[model samples]
Target: MKNILLACSAGMSTSLLVSKMKEAAEEKGMEVNIWAVSQDKAPSEMEKADVLLIGPQMRFMKAKFSKTAEEVGIPLDVIDPVAYGRVDGEAVLNKALELMGE
Candidate 1:
């Protein structure tokens, strides 16, 4: 199963998106473990994630987390603002899959 991690300022904003993404994954018959954490908790969480997608509002943290992501050997990217704004879970899930070279 793929482990997808979403990191935002407080970790609360992504909860809805996570539910949407889970629905999308179920539709696609994909088995994934997805969760969200605050920026402060993301570094430790990264080690368990297959890919990391940061919230649009927390895009600035990407640079700070890139080094850790590199060390963890996982792909990291900022969520698309449009999709994020709309809470488009399928798009975010697809982005994560693409990052994993799926």
Candidate 2:
């Protein structure tokens, strides 16, 4: 199963999106594991992530996370503010896949 990691400030808000993403994945017949984590734990938690998407509020951390992501070979991107604010799981999922070059 593909692993999609979503990281935000405290991991709380993204939890809501995680459920929706799981639903979206299922609708597409995808066997995937998706979860959310705090920015503090994201680096160590993402070793197995096929793709990592950070919250727009934490976009500044991209450069730092980018270094760690490169070492682990995980594609990373910032979630779109519009999509995130609306909690549009399909849009976020599409963005993750796009980042992964899927």
For model 2, name the residue pairs that clash.
none
Top candidate on TM-score is 1
Error of 1 at 69 (Å): 0.2
TM-scores for all predictions: 0.99, 0.97
Write the residue-wise lDDT of candidate 2 on 1-102 in tens digits.
889999999999899899989989889998889999999999998897999999999999999899999999999999999999999999998888888887
CA RMSD of each candidate after superposition: 0.4, 0.7
So what's the TM-score on candidate 2? Answer: 0.97
**83 in model 1: Cα distance from truth in Å?**
0.5
User: lDDT tens digits, residues 1-102, model 1?
Assistant: 999999999999999999999999999999999999999999999999999999999999999999999999999999999999899999999999999999
Q: What pairs collide in candidate 1?
A: none
Query: lDDT (0-100) at residue 41 of candidate 1?
Result: 98
Q: What is the lDDT of candidate 2?
A: 0.93
Note the Cα lDDT for every prediction shown. 0.98, 0.93
